[model samples]
Target: MPVSASYRWSPFCVDGVTTVAVKTLKENAAEVEKKDLLSELEVMKSLDPHVNVVRFLGCCTDKDPIFVIIEYVNRGKLQTYLRNSRAERHYGNTHGKSNILTSGDLTSFMYQVAKGMDYLTSRGIIHRDLAARNILITDDHTCKVADFGFARDVVTSKIYERKSEGKLPIRWMATESLYDNIFSVKSDIWSFGILMWEIVTLGSTPYPGISAADVMRKVRDGYRLEKPEHCRRELYNIMYYCWSSDSNERPTFLEVVQMLDKLLHTEMDYIELERFPDHNYYNIVNLSGEKL
Candidate 1:
């Protein structure tokens, strides 16, 4: 199958068990971001591979069309799943479904993501872009952080300085990054908050209809995206803490994992009810394993 989109790349099935997504940096392509792609490759190479990270199998650089070979995820992007979930919740009949992600499923996914980030952090790598779109899921319902296209090696001082010079996703960026273009492990925590929000909100657009500049302004002015009605207060509070203006105030990735663990393991009747209103909500069903 060939993935279709206007994002300047296509995914093709390589074999029954494997597929490859090729991101080409061609001379004739319009607005080629060669540096960005190369930087991503460099970052991916530096970090040790983990199951929670999309594996970098190989690349094709000698040919005219430079391409990076990566492990293909059969399930596609996390954002796609979120959008589907949102649609099901809003319009579809979700009774007796078996594959839908419940709060527990989300917690498991978050833990996996955190484990991946923790591994990256231990290796002194920072995923500069940590958004729903950048995360990919597998056939077995495992979550992996992908799209190192924006990642940077933390050990390189010059790269760190350059990365700190701005370059952030406005809506998902931490407040400190918005103002100073500075990112440390702490700023990543802020991004994690946004990621958590995305998972819970079923991939709703962050700061919807707002310009990047305006998002920065509002964030600086102590504004944050409102929690959805179904969002748990504890989870929302955790997200709020992650968005704290002071980068130092944000929790570490391990801390985030612990918090999430607590939330997932401890059965808080109120929070559970608030997060999932009806029995039908938790039973929305995940149809990913079935053949489409």
Candidate 2:
């Protein structure tokens, strides 16, 4: 398997007016890579269109470099968006429209992700890797779940075990996944908690300053990430809930959606993204899992 591969942003006007992104595989991609791309295509084709999920446009498999076309998200990765927003605020860049987010904006992002995850779980799909980097942000700030390379269908069996060893998101992984290579909707929920942390921290890499080996040891020892300075206690509590050691204890995506919805409508702000310190420390990290 390739150490790192990303969908190329090849925007073309398919209809001479409407543009789309094409995910192209490398010219010399291995057989396993081709199979993975095909698997991703199958999964995307099976999914129904949802506001919070990236829309699959079409594909081209007859050619040497297979193409998996998808809807174009102008703002790009949510991780990059958040980091840029932080930079904008830090440097007082008022040249154009500000990207500084409000409490409602942040809450809406969390709610959108939960809704997307709910839809995927309903379709019996497990987004093995759920993080900010895998999510895309539209120009309107709508968050959509993207990247299905690690996704699996669990309609028949509720659990999926990894028999092959490869790169894993240890920092965002659940306890069972870390220890036994087991993956399920519950593990995705745990990763969602990490995603929430990323949102609040402006895309800070999880377990910042900690080594991968240390992250595994600490997570196994019942250690959880502390709440961010700008994160509210209530929101932090919700994140903590997602990190429950027992997978069964974690709330379903629907429940998470409900919680976030309620939080969004409430008078009290669950989090204040505008309060993020000017001297922010969060930065985008490699999503290739090579660091791990």
Candidate 3:
């Protein structure tokens, strides 16, 4: 079973102007593995659509080469965008119109991710591979969650269950997830914290000098990634909260949205969110889980 391969068409389109991304099993994948890929695709299709999530247009899994068509994000991966933007910020240091993100822009990214995360958590999905690299950016700077290859329905799980085994992104994972393969919403929140750090630092790699093996030991010993040098203390606090060893204490994605909402207001012009109730907009969802 070939575990790696993908095709991206330079001129792929749905209606001439409507661009899209098409995903399918690696051409070299064994016939036995096709079923696994199709099953996962079906699970992803069951998820309700949301702006924060990469929309799936359709799929064809009836035969040899199953394919799933999804939305095409113009700017590509969030990590790549941040890295390029960061370089541009240093090269010219342009103001007002530079692609460099302001604190306001950072908050916008956080808000969108949280909104999408809230939707996922609400629907019982656990994105085991949540990270900056898994997020796609559009030309308008809209961010969407991508790469659901590791997602599963863990909405009713009281505690994370260790994975049987797979290649996990250890750097962006929580301590429990690392040691036990256990995963849950809290695990996703931990990865979200790392993603936030990436955004604040304009795409600095997480744990620059730490090895995967040492990361588990360090985190278990109360070691957490320090705040990005340019991150505001308030925003850092939220990231810290997400990294709590007691997963039960970590705030739900909804709480994350509310806290980020407050920060966004403080950092820039406040806008009313019609989706949330006006009177109790700050009502945070407190999911019962272990504290990290």
TM-score of 3: 0.84
lDDT of 2: 0.84
Answer with 1 or 2, whichever has the higher TM-score. 2
lDDT of 2 at 63: 74
After superposition of all CA atoms, the RMSD between model 3 and the true structure is 9.4
Estimate the TM-score for candidate 2.
0.93
Candidate 2: clashing pairs of residues: none
Compute each candidate's TM-score over C-alphas: 0.81, 0.93, 0.84
Put the candidates in TM-score order, highest first. Answer: 2, 3, 1
List, residue by residue over 1-292, the lDDT tens digit for candidate 2: 1124533557778669888888877666767767777888999999999999999988888877788889988888888888887777677765776768777888899999999999999999998889888899888889999988788888889789977666777888998998998999999999999999888887888887777788889999999998878788989999999999999999999999999988988888776666766454545355455432
Give lDDT: candidate 1, residue 164.
Answer: 26
Candidate 1 lowest-lDDT run of ten: 283-292
For candidate 1, the per-residue lDDT at 227 reads 72
Model 2: per-residue Cα lDDT at residue 196: 93
- The all-Cα superposition gives candidate 2 an RMSD in Å to the true structure of 2.5
Query: Candidate 2's error at 271, in angstroms?
Result: 2.1
Q: Rank the candidates by lDDT, best first.
A: 2, 3, 1
